[model samples]
Every structure is written in structure tokens, then in C-alpha cells.
Target chain A: MAEMVFQRTKGLQDRPFHYCPGCTHGIIHRLVAEVLEELGVLDKAIGVAPVGCSVFAYDYFNCDMQEAAHGRAPAVATGIKRVHPDKVVFTYQGDGDLASIGTAEIVHAAMRGEKITTIFVNNAIYGMTGGQMAPTTLVGQKATTSPFGRDKNHAGSPIRMSEMLATLEGPAYIERVTVTTPAHIRKAKKAIRKAFEAQIEGKGFTMIEVLSTCPTNWGMSPVEALRWLEENMIPYYPLGVYKASEEVK
Target chain B: MAKVLMKGNEAIGAAAIKAGCKFFFGYPITPQSELPEYMAREMPKAGATFLQAESEVAAINMVYGAAGAGARVMTSSSSPGISLKQEGISYIAGAELPCVIVNIIRGGPGLGGIQPAQSDYFQATKGGGHGDYKMVVLAPASVQELTDLLMEGFDIADQYRNPVMIIGDGMLGQMMEPVELREPKKRNLPPKDWATTGTGGRGHTNVINSLFIDPAECEKHNLKLKAKFDEMEKNEKKYEIYNCDNPDIIVAAYGTTSRIVKTAIDKCKDEGINVGLIRPISLWPFPYEVFEEYADRAKAFLSVEMSLGQMVEDVKLGVNGKKPVYFYGRTGGMVPVPDDIVAEIKKILGGAK
Candidate 1:
């Protein structure tokens, strides 16, 4: 029998995820769990799942998990981290949850310099709700609500959370990364680990925005979706650390 | 460890911090604005989280989020603001999350007034949120009680995995008194094993939610909540009976009004009027039996309140029509003084003769 070499990452259950094929949420989830395993912070960490496509993240992450109201994961993580300062607390939020309803919460948490990490998955469309225009939807991007593509005259400009948050002096780290390909996935993992490390170091407010793919919403095949992210999303949401403490160097 | 003069609202806030509460979310409102203010400055120094939400709705939702994450979270607002929080409160109740909500009640039918009032008696006791739910409501008549109740509220909330309400009025929130801050006992909370802390090989992941789609499942959940409430009513009902021996009249009140009544009863005693007071500490599981015993002997009972006539109904129910239950109150931002209560008690007692 051929030895099974590549399997789903540990800490994530064998159960098939609910994400559509080519959906990058699975990749991001695996990356988070992998980082937690590598850091050996799984038992000492808590994760808040947002109210979006990944609402069932509690089912995927092997660690203690909580489901927050739409857009309120940051607030919840703040609560958890404050109560259990010794434990690592992080929020896994989607574009809709983080950029729209939860805007104030995430912004204030960052502004207050809360000692928590936030994993922001930005696919630029409302996936679970079926392709609605997200706050981060690029200009001229086609979505269900933006059938004519996002009109700059109509819809406001896409929000760059990493850059916006970096402007605040409170955040110890802020970075945007993509998971469209293997090399980018590795970089994304490094950014994610840096965020968790910031928290472990008692640094305040670290967020990593993962530029993701929602093939189902974008109406593209998985491979094509990855290419689309590289060509279109990258220029709009450049992948790099917008802010990090010099001490981390 | 030492006595300090503190406003009731500030004392409650200070007590919560001392009790290890590290998360606070609130929107400013009259009568209770000092609570969030106190937390804002103190939480940071304590290495806690504090946020002034955009609206009362958002504030309570934030509290819901924090509580679900197994934090000792709290929120405070007056009547109108508390009404806005009903939606999130219902969710917190349904999720069985531990939290504390302080209601410094003001007069209200709608934006009623920014004065002290006990009008929210029914709302606090009957669960201010939708669905079948009950919060352990603690009414504090004095600054000491307010501080003690804040600590007790946290304990009760964690013990039952449910939200508890520290129900005070504007008077209690604003009054200043000497209070000895007691050292908080270490909490006996189980490790937030069920919290969203990363599972780390925990047997199974936990979900905190209020949505039960199936009617039967919803019923079962509600019934569980009801059972917890029943157990609380039996085990946690608390009240204070003052000068009940050979009293011809018993006064029923709570919170600041009860304190006023205490003084009025003293005045009544000076005038040879035999009056006593039964102050409900646990306003929801009211001291109904105690009031009944007093009603059994007293010829008349008076409910002196700051609201039009909210708690008087409870007093009537407790009295069970055995005696004449009179109500005298000042509403719409007006607070009835001790003299007003004494006058009413004198009239009721004179009529009984």
C-alpha cells in the first residue's frame, strides 16, 4: 500500500469543511491551526469565530472556540484575552464581519491597543450571504448586490484595514498577506505566526489580513480564482507588513 | 480593606474591578453615566478591556461577545438605555453566558425622566428581554449593599452561567456614602473549559449560541432556564425585615426608596405610629412570604416608591388583599422625600384606626 504522505493538517478534524471548492478559508484555517501547533499554544489559546462563512470554525479548530455575533469577534477576543491574560486569544473574522458590522469594534480594539491577535480573512465579497458587495470589494468587482460591478461613484472605496489600523499607534503589528499559492501561503503563515507572537510577547493589538479567494462568489474555478487574486486583489491590497514594532526585528 | 466615601454607581464599578472583572462595554446615558466613566479610567490600569459602544444596542452586544468568550463582563445603563439592550440581553440569556448588567433606573414609560425611580421593578424581575428568561436581580438600598451586590452579582452570574442584574435607581447611583470595600473571595469558577479558548486537545469544541430552530429544542432550553430560576428563587431569595415586632403598619419598598422608608419608619415611631419595613433584596424572587406574614398582622401596608406605582403591585400581590395597600409616589423625575412617605403612612395608619 502506498504510504499516505500529505493529509489534512492536524488540529483540524478530518470532517470535510463547508467551504466551497477553491475557497481559501480552508487554507487560512489550516494555517492558523498549524501555527498554533508549531508554537505549542493550542491549549493556551482561545479562538473567536465570526458570523460569516466560517461561523462553523469552532467545528474546524481543535482548540477552545466561540462563535461571535456578526462583526463582533474582536470585541469578544478582547474580553477573553483580558479575562485570561495568560491564554492566547484570537479572532478569526471574514471580510463582512470585520469590515462592515464589526468595523467599530475592530477599530476601537486596535485603537485601545488590546493585547489580542485578529485573523482577518478578506475575500472582498459576502460569501455565505451569496456574493454581496463587501466593504473591501474592489472598484468594478462584480458581486450580487453590485451587479453593475462596484461603482466608485456609488459604493465607497474599499477599506484597507491593515493600513488604516497601522495609522493607529496602538497596534504592535499589522500585516496583509495572501493564500492564493504555495509561496504566498508560506508568507501568509509567517505573518500569522508573527501576529500570534506579538500577543505572546505581550504586545498590544496584532492583526493579519489574509487576502483570500471565494471562487464560488467570484464565479471562477479554483485555479483561475488564485490567478485572479494575484492579478487584481494584490495590487489593491498589497501583501506586506504595514506596521510592526522595530523591536521585533 | 478600608472605608471610603464613594458614589453608589462608582462603588459598584470599583467593586467589580476588585472582583476581577476585566471587561466592560457600555453606552452613556443619564443617571448611570458614571459607571462607564469609572470603568474607562480603571480598566486600563487593571489591564482590562473597556469600550464605549456606539449605541446601547452595540454596547450590550459587545458584552454578549465578551461574556461568550468567558470573560467577567459588565454593562450599565438607565431605563431607556436598558430597553435598547433587551435584544442582546435575550441572546446572552439564551446562550447561558455569564455577565452582569447594572440598571440605574430612571422614570420611564418612554424617556420618562432622568431621575431616580423604582418603576422598572416589573421589567427587571420579569426579565427585560424577550423569551422566557430570568436574571438574578439584586436591589441595593445602601452604598454598602451596592458594593456587596456587585461582587455577589459576579458570583451568581458565573455560578449559574447566566446574566445577573444589579438593579438600582438614579438615587442609589448618585448617592455618596461611607462604604468599606471588602476583599473579593477568589472565584470558584470552573476553568473556562467550555469557553472559546483554543481547544488544545479538548474533547470537543464548544459553541455559545441562542438560536434553537426546532420548537421542541427551544422549549427544552427554556425549561432548563426556568429550572435554574426556580432553584434561584428557593435558594437565593433575600430581603430585610426592619422593626416588625408589634407593628400595625408595614411598608414595602426597595433600593433607595427602601432606605428613605427606613428613615420615615423611624419618624413614624417618634410619632407613636407602629410602622415597619420589608425591603426586598432579591427583587425578582421578591420577599413575598415575608410580606404576607406582615400583612397577616398589619392593618394596612404602604408602598412608597419613586415611580407612579410599579412596586405597589408586587406589594399588593404579597399582601394578598388581606389589608389595604396604599401607594404614594413621585414620578417623572420627581423623587418623593421621606416626609412624603411619612405623611402617607400617617394617613393610612389613622384610617386603619
Candidate 2:
């Protein structure tokens, strides 16, 4: 008999993913849950879901969860991590929840050196709010709100969250990875493990920015979305390690 | 527990510590800055946590996070800063997390003056944010009352699993008074079994949320919240009466204005006029029963406040049109003195505005 492998990760619940058919949030969530399960921190992980497409993450993640208001998940994660310093804490947020309204929250939380992990999914569009223009949307990209292409003169260019956040001295590790291909998905899982490892070692403020594809919001097929992500999103958001603290480095 | 002479802002800090608040998140704002400063200096020494957040929006969300994790937490700010916090407040209220908030109100419609004012009365008692929610609004009339109310405020928050606010003014915050701090009491309270503490070995994920997309679900949530508000109205009505045994006129006021109104009532008594006073301690509960007792017998009602009569609306509603209600107020950080209130009461009784 052939040995069996690749069983379902016990870190996630049996509930089906509620994301759009071709969106990569389900893939990203699987990577995170698999990493926590492999690290033996599944039951001890406290996840904070932001007010965007992944807002119902509490039902999907098989752990204690708290849903935060839009853009406020970092601050909420800070509060939770502060009270239980020994527990593993993470926040799953999208572009609109992190870069636009919660800019202050994410920046200040990073500056304070809060001991927690952040899984930032950048799809470059507001998937939960009817595909509105996001702060991470490419300059030429058209959104529901930006019916015409995004004008850099008026809307500004896409914000490089990992690059910008790495400039702060508080974070222990900061990396931007992609999940467009199988090789990239494996690398993305490795980055997610390193983020949680930093927290396990008591390193402060670790974050991983996963460049994901939103097929429904991007108005592309699954294959087209993956190709577009590699072609368009990767150039603006180059995938690599942006920052690593002295101990982690 | 010595009767030390301390500022009201400092007293509030001591009260919160006595109430077992293990964490504090706040930002600097006028008049109330001293309160956060007090927490910063004292919380660390007590082996607790203090974080000066980037903004009021960040501060309140920080409180939301801490409270969701089952820790007793608090935050403080002034008028403008509190306005910036309404978004987080609505979420915290909707999530049913227990916490304490302090609003050292000043004059305002936009960055109003830093002096004491009761202008935030409506904002505190009525819905300050965009929601159908309520907070147990506690208005303290003195520095001692500030300490007493906060001791009860933290418990009130924990008991109801809701947010409770102590809205004072710049005078109470800046003034110094003798206060004998209450010793810490381990009250018999229910455990926070529903908090998200990483689930432990419970084998069940505890979720803290308020979002319900379906209209029927949202309406059901609204009904559940409304029932809690109704319970608060039943059990939390609080007010104090001064010389109401038999009165021809009643003066309605709270916070700093209540002190001045008390003097005006005394002056009226000396002048052989039957003028009593009603000070609503729980502003949301409104203490309307006090008005029901005197509305039938009193000749009229006078609502005096430091703002342009914000609390007057509640006073009229409490009176329920049984007697003609009069309002005399000063705005823009101006306080009406005892003589001014007495003059207004006399003119009103004399059938004048």
C-alpha cells in the first residue's frame, strides 16, 4: 500500500471558504492555518479578522477569533497580544483595511514594537465593498469607484506597505511574497512560518505581505487573475524580504 | 486611603486603579491630558500597562482590543478627541465588550474652548455615534463624586458587559479637592467566560463581533440591545433631590452646573421662595421619576446648564409637559454664577424669559 500524505490541516474548521471562486484569500488562509498547525500553535492561536472580504474568518479559522472594525485590526491585535503575551496572535487584513483607513493603526502598532504577527493580503482592490478602488490599486487599474483608470495625479500611486513598514525600527521581520504559482505558494508558506517563528522567539512585530489575486473583483478568470498578478502586481510589489531584525537575520 | 488633596483628574486615575483596571490607552487632549498623564506615571509603577496611542481613534481601538481579551481596560480624552473616538465606541458597544471611557468635556461644536462646559450632555446621553446604542452616562458634580462614580463606573461596565462613561468638565478635572480613595474591593461578579482568551482547552472558538448582514438578524440584535437598554433604565435611574419635600419650583442641572444651581436654590430659600433642585447623576437613565414626583405640584421647572441648554431636552421629556419648563444657559466655556441663576429663576417666576 502507498503511504498517504497531504491530509487536511486540522488548524482550519470544516466550514467551506466563503471567498469568491477564484480569489486567493482561501489559499492564503490555508497557508496560515497549515503553518500554525505545523508549528504546534493551532489551539493557542488567536486570530483577528478585519472588516473586509475576510471578515468572516472567525468562522473559518479553527481558533479563538475577534472581528475588528475596518482598518482597526492591528490596534485590536496589539490589545489582545498585550494581555496574553505568551499566546500566538495574528491579523488577516486586506488593502482597504490596512493602507487607507487604518494607516495610523498599522504604522503606530509597528512603531510600538507590539509582539504579534500580521498576514496582510494585498489584492489591489476592495473586494468586500463592491470592488471599489483601493490604495494599493495600480495607477492604470480601473475600479468601480475609479470607473476611469486610476490617475496618479489625483489618487496617488499604489502604496508599498511592506517597503514602507520596513522603514520603521520596530518590526522583527517584514516580507512580501506571492501565491501566484505553486513555487511561490510554497515560498509564501515558508514566509508565513518565519513570521510565526519570530513571535515564538519573542521577536516583536512580524508581518508578511502576500500578493493575492481577486478574480471576481479584477474581472478576470482564475488563470487570467494569476497571470495578471504575476505581470502587474509583482512589478509594483516586488516579492522579497524587506526587513529582518538582527536576531532573526 | 488617606484623605489626600488631589486633583479630580488624579482622583479618577486612583479610582480606576482601585477598580482593578490593568490597562489604559489614551491620547493627550486639553483639560483631560492630566488624567492620561496621571495614568502614565502611576500605571507603570503599579505593574500595569499604559500606552499613549497615536490618536483618539487608536486609543479607543486599543481599549477595544484589551477589553475583548477579558482585561479591565480604560481610555480618556477631551471633547474633540472624544468626537474622533465615536467610530470605535460604536464598535465596542456593538461587540458588547466591557470598558471605561472618560470625557473631560469642554465647549464645542468645533475645537471649542478648553474651559468646563456641559455641551457634551446630548452627545453622551443621546447617540453620539451612528448607531442605535446606549452607554451608562455618569455625570459627577464634584471631585469626590468623580472618584465615587468611577469606582461604580468600572463595576457597572463589567456587570452589564457594556461601556460606561464618566463625563465631567474642565473645572472638575482642574480643581483640587480632598478625597479618601476607596480601598480595593473584590466584588462578587460573574466571570467573563465568553472572552477570547485563545480558547485554552475549551475546544470552542469564542467570537467577539456585532456585524449581522441579514436584516432580520440585525433587527434581532437591535432588539436584544434595546432590551438591555430597557433593563438599564429599570435598574440604573440615579438622581439627587435638594429640599423637594414641598416646592413650587425645581432646578434641573448636573456636573459643575449643579453646584451653582444648589447655591441659587439656597438663595431662593432665604428669600422665602420654594425652589428645590434635582441633579441627574445617571444621565442616560435620566432619573425621570424625580420629575414625575414634582411635575404635578411644582409651579414650573428650570433647566440650567453650562452649555446652551443641551440637557434641557431631557428635562422637558422627563417632565412630560406637566408643567412649563424654562431653560437658562451660558455657552462657549462661560459658567452661570449663583446670582445669574437666581435672577433667571426670579424673572421666570415673574413671567419673564
Best by DockQ: 2
Pairs with steric clashes in candidate 2: none
For B1-353, candidate 1 gives per-residue lDDT tens digits of 67899998899888999888988988999998898999898889998878787677767877876777667889999999989888778878888898999999888789888888778878888877788998889998899989988898898888888888988887788889999878645656666556665554666666777766579999999999999888778977889988888888888888887877888888888988888888889987877888788887788888887778878888899888888999888887787788888888877777778
Q: How big an interface RMSD has model 2?
A: 0.8
The CAPRI class of candidate 1 is acceptable
Q: In angstroms, how far off is B57's CA in candidate 2?
A: 0.5
- The whole-model C-alpha lDDT of candidate 1 against the native structure comes to 0.85
- Quote each prediction's TM-score: 0.82, 0.98
Look at candidate 1 and tell me the lDDT of residue B71.
Answer: 78
DockQ of the two-chain complex in candidate 1:
0.36
What lDDT does candidate 1 reach at residue A12?
A: 78
C-alpha RMSD in Å of predicted model 2 compared with the true structure: 1.5
Docking class of 2: high
